[model samples]
Target chain A: MKTFPIIRVVTKILIPYILLFGCYVQFHGDYGPGGGFQAGVIFASGLILYGLVFGLDAVRTVAPPRVIEKLMSLGVLIFAGTGVLTMLLGGNFLDYDYLEHHVLPGILPTGQHLGLFLVELGVGVTVTAVMTMIFYAFAGRVQAKHVQAKQEPTP
Target chain B: MTAIDVAILLFLAITAVTIARIRDLWAAVMFTGIYSFLSASWMLLLDAPDVSFTEAAVGAGISTVLMLSTLALTGTTEKASGAKFRPIPFMVVVLTGCMLIYGTLDMPQIGDPSDPIHIHPSPSFVERTQGDMHGLPNVVTAVLGSYRGYDTLGETTVVFTAGIAVLLILRRGKEEDSKTGGRPGSAAASGDNA
Candidate 1:
């Protein structure tokens, strides 16, 4: 079932483009319409498409469950850590103005720019991980159920 | 309203009715995706491009896929037992719909610049984004990331907690293995095996 030629060919052609677009949306969110939420979903959709075409095991191989588990928390940590860093830098929580105190006075805006990028990246990572984790759990449970049904015949 | 707006609205109404009437859960999921796509177009017409983009991606794409995956785990055929109309539930639904419609009557006209919501922080957010907020072109990002940073932080935490909850409930690996593998010929496992 995973080896269907048409699906395999089309998915192979489309996956990289979809992932690239997801990254574009993630970064361009500051100037454009989409943001972390949308980009994360699009990114997860690319992986989900891969899962749908190549089966659950293939996706697990690409993104193991343990790695997904860590990513889910890592993103949150990054977001909160940014805030804590701001606080430690003698500013209010999440205050990006204090991010680059050592930089030249003329480039103060760099702090805000970098801060926004990191915050958005954190949001994107967490959302992508959660969505993929949920899909994996559901799909894996179903697949395991099917596998069990096949392996052990019912009386 | 423009012709395009009217046409899109009419299609939305048709899709809603079809979704209600469709007996097959799978078809209903597809129709729901269509409904999201139509509403996204309407949002674009209403000049909410960001919202439209989100509606298209989350509502139409990811949600449709999730619903399909759910259908794979559940029954595709919706039960037909609801044919007999229950007057009490019907009245409840009608009353809720009427209340919702009445609630919208108090809303300011769409795109009214002077609306209460547009008066305070929004004007400042727009004005100051170019100056105090590091001259960011996207006022929405500036507002969300800086002005309302606390709110966004809380929202991220909420999402994190939801992920944890789903993992806890759905990823019960050991329990599931014990349930299925421990009793292969048991009635519950056997019923599911078929």
Candidate 2:
């Protein structure tokens, strides 16, 4: 893989834009065709491409497995916490109406806009973590099997 | 159906048959990816851009990579079955396909304005989301995020649970590896134990 300078160079140039598009899809979802799920998959695809090109060890350094495990749970917590917060604020479960605070009055209304953003963000985070984690698990198994094959060559 | 629709469907059918007939697992996976891309194009033609976006990214992209990785662990060539032709299973498949096609005869025509789907809560959701979601232009987002937030929460939880299940099945702790004298069992056997 290190011998493929062309692939390495092209991948380096393309990754940043891929990540940027993922963010665009994530935040602009309210006005566009993409939302959290699509955006998360796009983002994870970029990382997966990097892993495919540059070894798994490189990707593990870029996105540590421990942090990904924690983030996987954290995204769910963020989503449920938003619902609980709405409840605590004297509303029904996941009712975004209570989130209206009149902050930045002339701009977008605070309630549904803010709630949707936070909820979608939660979805994006969890999806990205889970997709990356699954890739790691599969690739790790292949690596482990290769190591075994090297240590004890079968007849 | 439109010419473009027919063309895509024709390609999709060809790809499916190729995947089934192919002996090489690697080629089958690649054809499956092609099939997903064609389906995504068909979804876009049906005027559901959001669904198309997801289908392209997940089905065409991530699924292909994951299948390739799985093929790396398993052998690249599918083993030949002991019995080449099983008439009972073939008959069952043909019967099921005919039954499914028969079931579609009762459904409404595609994009019929008088259909129940267009007449019911869909219209109300579209009308209300403008006011309720503060003039949000994308009704799909508003509906998923606010109107049916609980369902989305459940979906997210489902994804989380699936990840946890995969981790439990695939992950081998460093302590377990050392304890087992660095000779871990096959993934399936260990997964069963876990």
What would the TM-scores of all predictions be?
0.86, 0.90
Q: DockQ of each candidate's interface versus the true one?
A: 0.44, 0.54
On residues B113-140, what C-alpha lDDT tens digit does candidate 1 reach at each position? 8999899655675777788556668877
User: Where does model 2 sit among the CAPRI classes?
Assistant: medium
lDDT, candidate 1, at B43: 94
Q: What is the C-alpha RMSD of each candidate to the true structure, in Å?
A: 6.4, 6.6
lDDT tens per residue, model 1, A12-98: 999999999899988988887777777888898889889888777567667766788888888888888989998998998899888
lDDT of 1 at A58: 65
lDDT of each: 0.82, 0.88
CAPRI accuracy category, model 1: acceptable
Q: Which ten residues in a row have the lowest lDDT in candidate 1 chain A?
A: A101-110
TM-score of chain A of each: 0.91, 0.94
